[model samples]
Target: MTDRIAMIAVDWGTSNRRAWALDSDGRVLAEMGDGEGLLKVDAGGFARSFADFAAPWLTDDRVVPVLMCGMVGSKMGWAEVPYIAAPADLASLSRNLYAIAFDGPARIAIVPGVSCIHDGVPDVMRGEECQVLAVLTQRQMRDACLLLPGTHSKWVQVKDGRLDSFRTYMTGELYNALTSGGTLAQLMEKGEADPEAFRRGLARAREPGSGALPHLLFGVRTLGLFNALPRAGLSSYLSGLLIGTEMRDALAWSTARAVIAVGSPRLLENYRIAAGEFGLAFEAHDNSALLPPALHMIARDAGL
Candidate 1:
């Protein structure tokens, strides 16, 4: 590799695309991104979209190595990079990655996501693996629990710098669905997180039993129906119920040295609060903080 080679790292997700140009020292030289996510771009036009965003940095002498992550590795995106089952390290993931050439003067390599079979169910992830690996690299935490809160909250268990196992919860998606399509939508108002109501719902979810979810959901309607809990707090109540339930279940197998929460501040804060309520110790870091190291690891692993 040339000493002055410009490497680009791309995190292309369902709703957005972010690209960063890095120097040899892993310092960001230029950054560009847009909302032309995989879901928005035409299937055949991915190369064009990427070229449009990366064109200004392209030079005749430069052969940029692009390390991509996110939905770009999915079947609906550019090319399907099949996931490698965990107990995986950076070297192993890079060795198993699937790459393709671009019409432009660049060497493109996409990061393969991770998948694991738990209890006979196949669970998969794309972009979040990069962040988790990045965190592991940065913090040097040998064994830790990684919590990524989003549309599908992921509870990942990494041991000795390798992914051991993980589980996914549809807390955010379910909250959206219930608020938008379910009958609870009419009884709730669009509002911010209500800490008090969230605490109450969390307590309800932590109860010892198998039918906790159904029972709590029943209460969501019954309370509204009987004018027990305030109508405005219904959304927050439901949010807490789902998140709390996830936390309760995850606690059963959370035997890590530390818990690392990654995501936006709002979501991380809620997770932090929930963890505290559950008597768990955790640290929260914004998702962006994990990007640079993640890209660096990807580049190193890809031999860029």
Candidate 2:
């Protein structure tokens, strides 16, 4: 923990923020995180908010290098960094870093997000681009599909070590909204996972005539009411249904031969299960691989 710090790597997003103090060799020396997301930090309060977590590094005499990614570079972040167009790689991302002029000795750089025009519609991502780079670089992958699952799941394609295209799904958000209130929530608790019920939900999503999700979601309540699904395990069923639909939608856009799932164990397992049910190939990746090396590469390339 007392190692000489080389750089501060940060992953700041909408709901939370985390930072790591890395040594000269890109080894993490210490780490910290807080729930003060972009939404919680008030207007013109980014510097103050950041200092709360990174104060120890932002000293008077040391020009501690800091590299940040995610929503921290968005319009609502400390600075509104523009998004780098798609068909980009680590080089482009590093080149477009938005440097924040700190009055102190800390040198701050924010990684730009990625954007693309898909089928005449605009799509954007704030944080997952870094994760994509980390995976592609570490695996020496030239072309592949990468999935970062969370509230807003992302399906990204990397070609020739560059990010080519991506799409987002609100699977987790929809699950939260549906399970937080209404008839479904009333009958459900944070139930122990029922693998059978979960499979049933996935099956429902894949059914030949299952119709749209609105109708399928309504069936969750009906199944509970009719005792078709146990009330205690209704939550898992809803989760499977949403995740299944997400996979179904994403399959159409993903051109890569196989998909790499990147997230926590639970998240990766869920996506793996869904991918399996869909008969799609999947590989689990360590989420920890996303930040440290990616930040180091960017900082080194940028001459930080």
Candidate 3:
């Protein structure tokens, strides 16, 4: 690749797509964002979408090398890049990447997602690896636990800047399903993050016992029905239950002292609250802060 070659890094998930054109130093030269997420675009129209967003950079002698992560590599995505199992470094991830040609002028590379088998459970992650790589680049820790809060939250364990293992929780998805789905959906009003109710839910989740979640959820519903819990607090209560349960499960396997959470401010704030409720120390890093560093790591690993 020539020094003039523009490198584009993309993070495409289910609902949104982001692209950055970077110089050799990995500084963002130009950026584009759109709602043409993998789930929303037709497989055949991927090239068109790529061309439309990247047309400006494709001119002249700039032969762009595009590196993408997230659902773009999923079975339901443009192309399925098979996963690289855990205990992986940037090199391993780069080696496992799937490349395909677009009839367009640019060269495209899709970063393969990561997966791992732990005690017979198959775990998978897409865009979070970039966040992990970004964390390793930014911090000097020898070992750490990174929590990525989103629709599918990931608790990743890293040792010496390499991914050791991780787990995924369906916290956000469950929250959405319960809020938008049938009968029980009408029981609560949304749009408020009630800290008090959240705290109450967190306390209930921290109680000792393996099977307390179901009973607790039942009680939440009962409280709503009997005018015990305010309708406005129901959303926060449910959020706490899901996140708190995740915290319980994450703490079971985590041995790291410090936790770095990556996500939006609202999500990270919730994570901070949950961590505090669990007596764990944590620092929140916005997901966008990791983007440029992750692109640099991808360049380094791919020798771009």
Candidate 4:
């Protein structure tokens, strides 16, 4: 029932937004999701967009606080929530939350992203931190490396319950770029997915003599031209190559022997395959199960 709901947790991304109505213990009571992400918010402003989205849950006889994460707090969002630098923990996220003023009965707050310097290269993540928190806490872990795969994949390290550092890999974005439109895109038209092709690509990534990826990437088309690889399998090959390459470097990037992979099942499947190729072990976790609990934890800590 609506009365049983305590808060609404929104994970607003670039192209989509998903919100959950949760009970006092962070258990889901109801849910809603749509393509109305940050970029798609109506011109009425974020408050309006939020009001429209939460209309179903805001049927409150009592106030239902809203906790949001992701681009909703970025410079382009309702308000720019300054990032909390690493090594960051759950407490830091709660402490640095940015509030949005509204006349609605419930208060609204957006969790700030985290920034870290990994190997002198500055990296930052918006929505993934909450998932990281959930993973660590759910698994009863104080130290672990987490892999959050998506358009921009993140390899995060947590130590003593804090996000020590993380690195971003443009694996998924690059895949889309290559296949969206280009010479490579043309070759993938009739391609059937081939696991062997993917495995071969993964093997190619780990080869010492494969040289730099830029030099090797062109093979996706050449193999097709020579009939050495099927056109339909080229996409799978490209996927394996990129993910395998990420694994090759990421495995070396962190000292953690195994990683906890978090994200949609569809996205994590390829990563799981790549992990197998690298002889690396990983545990898959669905973000949907993790984010709400994490948001609730943040809300509780923020005294919402």
Candidate 5:
């Protein structure tokens, strides 16, 4: 009785995966996901792993189109789908899909990642493109500056509904490394998220001679030691310092006065606050909400 299901769209990342079964009109009939991301998927185990996770929807005996986006298309993922150069649009994305032949009654296609050169260095994005495209199409916008926050955050610029160019920031990863038994780890791990302390870190990053990141980072420890910053506020200050630095540098990546960020509320809050400091209006879209229409659009345009 469930033959109306049209497509299975997956936003699979390195740390998590989510899939939705949608009808032709893009209505979600069921949703499934788990923390067993690409890292846990053993070599050559993607077929079984996908099958197990999609078992419920696959039971209908109909071969539906399964479009996967994110790190699942990376070299370490199920298959290394070649990245298409930037100024990319959904049409190019749909056309460049790498199809995987599965024994299950399903047609699987991996959405290739988008790549571009920034500051004369190569940069790329896998899963975030889906959200970017979703924001573009769903919002019916012709141009905007978009931000996707993560371990490697992205600053994207869209022109005429195409991804013109983008740059990646390792803010999250740096914060993790600094707090993972590193010099600043002890103090940063002691506190709740402190807004004012975070603001201080942000302000410090903008100081006249604060260009040297090492100097600014060392202040995290010294401030705590000197009782200038509280133990319970150290983590927040560190987060602010890094995010503030990222804002100072990345906000110039696009000329748009306002930035639309795609992430959950908790994640977007920091960026929103960062935007206010930099004097830019911030808009937010739920990361999960972007996948369904994005996949459906690609599949439809590709004539799948």
Candidate 6:
């Protein structure tokens, strides 16, 4: 027979949901997920949706304590769990969880997001904060600048194992909007990742000027129109431009000398390359390795 799951770990996001059946020692017993994200979960459907996805593991005749993190805790998600102010550690995060009595026998707790003021500007991160905590703990990083790339990319600074400050970059979403349905959609052509053209875009993004972004973005179309940038390379070039701009700006605010990129392999690769441009060493850790221990730490402290 399979090992008993001691805790149910859930990572619910805007687009997807993943739940892991974890044993007492935080080992994975089984896993399941779906597209029933916050966006798709209708009003009052969160409990039903969660129970359905977790049905297989719920066969045991007991209520399983669920520790969930991500956009599921956002205002638009199941419940509007308030954000935990920044300069916090795992202990603070675990202590401030938002709990709810499920319609069924199970007990559910949502991890609150973290907010910080960097350079007099307020920034917040929901799911990424948990990931950042996991990465810092797993790596035993004392002082590190961490990058989590996504639709809304995050650059977090950790000092002495506590979250000091961070910044959010709209790189991925901007690229998506520009290519998918935005004004520049007509100019971009899908193609394989081209390192050369990508580097060219990165260089363009680094050009010093007052209105460089708009000017450089327009260059993508003009360059393609004049047959300067190949159609097959336009997508990669645009990706480089966006990521490069993010790196160029984010790297300045970060105090750590090297960076740790935490995300998928493809996204990490882009960040690694971008970090190399600024002569910063890059390290990576996937979600699977970083998340399990992180969740356990938080849940345990929360008495879940």
- Quote model 2's TM-score: 0.95
Write model 3 residue lDDT over 58-163, tens digit each, in one string.
8645567788889988988889888998887788887777887788767788888888888999999988998888887778665789999999999999987789
lDDT per residue as tens, model 4, 18-111: 9999999889999989998778765448887888778877874677899999998888888889988999888899999898898786789999
Model 5 lDDT per residue over 71-175, tens place: 999989999999999999988998998999899978999888999986789999998888899999878999999999989999999999899999899999998
lDDT of each: 0.83, 0.85, 0.83, 0.88, 0.88, 0.83
lDDT of 1 by residue, 208-262 (tens): 7737677788788888899888888887778788989999888886765457899
Candidate 2, residues 74-140, lDDT tens digits: the string is 8778899998899989789988989998766678999999999988998899878888888888789
**What residue pairs clash in candidate 2, if any at all?**
none
Q: How many clashes does each candidate structure show, in the order listed?
A: 0, 0, 0, 2, 0, 0
| Residue-level lDDT for 194 in candidate 1 | 75
| Segments in model 2 whose C-alpha atoms lie over 4 Å from true places | 1-3
Shift of residue 46 alpha carbon in model 4, Å:
1.2
Candidate 1, clashing residue pairs?
Answer: none
Q: Which pairs clash (backbone N, Cα, C closer than 3 Å) in model 3?
A: none
Please list the Cα RMSD from the true structure of every candidate, rounded to 1 decimal place.
Answer: 2.2, 1.6, 2.1, 1.3, 1.3, 1.6
lDDT at residue 117 of model 5 (Cα atoms) = 87
- Give each model a TM-score: 0.94, 0.95, 0.94, 0.96, 0.97, 0.95
Displacement of residue 224 (Cα, Å) in model 2 is 1.4
Span of ten consecutive residues with least summed lDDT in model 5: 183-192
